[model samples]
Target chain A: MLFMRFRHLLFAIFALASGAAMAQNNPLTGLLRSLTNTVAPDQGKAAATNQPTSVMGVRGLDEVALKDATPAPAAVVELEKYAASAESATAAAKQTGLQERTVSYQKP
Target chain B: MTNFRLPVRFGVRFGVLSLIAILTSVVCAPVSAQTFNLNAIGSVVSGLVEGARVSNISEAEEIQIGKEISARVLGAAPLVKNEAAQRYLNRVGTWVALHTERRQLPWRFGLIESPTINAFAAPGGIILVTRGLYASLENEAEMACVAAHEIAHVNMKHHLDLIQKGALTQAGAKLLEMRSGGNEIKQFAIGQGAEIFTRSLDRGAELDADSKALVYVAAAGYDPGACPAVMKRLAAMKADASSLAMLYKTHPAPADRAVRMEEDLGKLAGAPAGSGLRPELATKIK
Candidate 1:
């Protein structure tokens, strides 16, 4: 009876430990795995090429994006145009918003 | 001739003594007035007083006065036809106004119906830009530099402060008010203030206004260097003697203003490099 109870307790402890580890590794899991491989000379190129640019808040995620992602020239220009349009709209809205007074003074 | 000598000598002596006493009295009276009113310099020729309880002159009495003055001036002058130019100027003015320390002042902008290349700010936030000013401006920054100077006049309460300090006597204020057909009391206040501004003409008001304006211009995300360039254009325009009179009568001449503005520009740091002047938009001026 004692041996059976002890075995069940051990199994429960193992499961909890594995769960905690998985949660901690979730966001940065892929990046960590790739970095670990890069440290190994033979595995570096293979892992680096396969690594994704975007990840869910993983460590060094922004740096990975800078290294791995390439935006098309046309896409960049389109994004800039959108930004310019938004700024222009904001300026125009401010200009048209004011109430102009109609009163006038005569010249002496 | 021989019979008239004694009487003539006595008359001449009396005249000389009277002149000396009159000059002495004239000199002595102002010293007393100046001593009592530390702000006597605040008054203008129009007789408006400052230190009146009005929190904002432009919002208080200047608005009505500005509109009235703008209307009368517009009647005699012709409006510039370029809608885009008007819009552009308003945009620049608005940008500067927003960045100024007195952003809450209900600043109103307008293009006056005149050919003179000048801009003047009446009491309140009434800013009058002329067609000639529009034609001369190279960019938004230039427009703002001029507007900022006008804004300083309003923000500093140079006019209203001048009046309330009793720079214009009760009688002086009433006389000028009657001439302008405005409320004699209000006109009195304005005239006194105008006197202060006129006296400051040779003083540092214009240069100080220019420096203050550059600060606002830069804050509004425009290049501060535009101030010197705008003054350069004004200087060029002033070369025409006919144009000089109108511009000088309202605003100070551009002759020394540009040089001093340039000197100030050199001392300033971190002003932006280039401005985008849309010639297509600018040339739209009539």
Candidate 2:
């Protein structure tokens, strides 16, 4: 009976170790992703077509994702374009001395 | 070693208790005693756990991006170049920034010529305070409070982290700094996620910035009582004008911040004999 009990304890320990390892591997760090994926099937298309490119415009949808796990792809595409444009602009600026034309804003 | 082993149940119990103790210690560790130069272990830990991930890019890359955006923004709509205000804000920001972890960064401070009531921190120690926010402030302490919080954002690398995380772009943080004449980029970046992240600083991040700002203002020998009063005034301003009015709109309302400030007042009550700004001088800036 003692040996059987020890075996059961070993299994529990092993289970806990595996759980920890799985958690370490998880990428969803900031907040837990809800399990139930009852996401609305077709919202990204509507948002992309209708929503203005403003922070507030997308916030309602972000809230939905937080509350109901409804993901929107429109935000992803917009963000990508924005980042790419900024990166290119920055690169272009570096190619020339574009940074020099601006008068120093700080006091000498 | 002698073959002495505990029962499996005892071992498991002991391990669980040890883990709990270690976690508690990690969470409860005080902000370091040394003049926390900001990149020390304590600050990095504080940032990782509570700092706002304002960008996803590397700090060096973010600084480069910030420099690029700042150059462009200033080129189009240059700061007023009012030497008085520039010197004043820089002096105050320098006081706060050195007290933070990322003190070594080439931080620059400026005042933009705009009526909009806002202040913001960009990557690489770049801070911009609009003439509007400056006019609204009643005293140097209030001004310091605002500057310190922005400095905390820089030190915590919140703006840069957000950009890297793809939540905010390099242009977005710059837009926050130069709101007036940045064209559509301002409107565009705001939609990119700055507003949501701006308004809702996680409770921990807010508290961390508050704590550091308070400590910095107090250490600089400004009136410690002034920080709380400034927060209360901002809360009132928000309540009257809708909370989103502040340039650095925090998600946790100013009232919530005021309450926290009140709770921390006891620790910051002692005023050192030094002075921050001459109110008379501050108002005299043309």
Candidate 3:
């Protein structure tokens, strides 16, 4: 039982350490990417001015941000003559699964 | 100015008391989880001050105000006749709007026929991007960038709040006592709204909108760098070009906005690239 307790504690510590590691890996977090970074909005503001090209070095905008934005929920509006005939398109999407629904974050 | 400060002054005593309470909480509680929710405290404090309202414009009235402004825009420049492009823009815009706090709003999108690179967000949820600006977009990410900035204006209620404050300034406490802005006041506010749009929002608000735009694009899975990239393109343009005259007049320099975007841009660095525009959507944009 004592060994099990020790194993549990070890697991908990590892889990927490990994979580911190993920946060540390975040591109936005700067030199001080720890819990202490939240204390001063002013310092955050000051740090912001010199960030980007200064901190990260100048990089191509396209190559840099490729932010992994989560796939957008399918847009509420349908496509291609959708508004003109919503009922038909809705039926087509439901029945034949052929209507083209668009989203912001399309899977490549 | 007198009217502007009246509503806030009524809560001065409560505000001070809350300040003390906040300070005490900060001293006693841990900074993370124990930190007080300023919004929750605000609601509690507001519950005590029922009479302190700056102006009362219902959502319907706000929408009406926006429609009036939108109608004026349409009166000036007809919407582009490309139905496919129109629906495409709506699809992109509505998708971006879903990421915002005010997603439930009846968002409407339009592409007006103008060569000027401009976009406008009216009081409610009407967003119009000019054809010139639309043509300038290299891809859907750039289109989303334009839509998100205007959406940010609506989400933040920047223009609506400005018009509300303007109406109060003109009509004073009468707006408050009336409870809701009456039709007459609404019409007057709409007129003021037109004039306000002709000018520009304050510098801070514009920069705030830029920051919000970056976040919105990122949230919607578009490249957040699209903002700075667009700004860089604008920066390279001749400011005196006829198409850019009104845009230049109403907005701060593109270089300044690009500087403002740097902070948020840093956050986007090394992030996974989002999806590219679908081929059919790309064709519509081109």
Highest TM-score model number = 3
Q: Can you write out model 2's per-residue Cα lDDT over B101-182, one digit (the tens) per residue?
A: 6766766766655555555566666676666667777776677788887788778866555534332122222322344333
lDDT of 3 at B163: 59
Misplaced by over 4 Å in model 2 are: A1-108, B1-59, B69-77, B167-200, B238-249, B268-286
Which lDDT value does model 2 have at B262?
A: 62
Candidate 3 lDDT over B1-286, as tens digits, reads 9887765764674465455554433332322221122222223233322332324667787777877776656555656778778776776677667667787777778876777778888877888787888888776667778888899888777787765554333233243335443554465456653344555688888887887777666666566666777888988999877677667766899988988886656654333444222122333543
Runs with alpha carbons beyond 4 Å of true place in candidate 1: A1-108, B1-59, B161-167, B170-187, B190-202, B238-240, B249-252, B269-283
lDDT of model 3, residue A3: 65
Question: What is the docking quality class of candidate 3?
Answer: incorrect
Q: How would you order the candidates by DockQ, starting with the best?
A: 2, 3, 1
lDDT, candidate 1, B47-143, per-residue tens: 3433222343336676555444444333334345445555556655765677677876656566655545556565666676766666666655567
Candidate 1 local lDDT, residue A37: 35
Model 3 ranges with Cα > 4 A deviation:
A1-108, B1-55, B175-184, B268-286
lDDT assessment of candidate 1: 0.49
Tell me how each candidate scores on DockQ against the true complex.
0.00, 0.04, 0.02
Model 2 chain B TM at 0.61
Model 2 in CAPRI terms: which quality?
A: incorrect
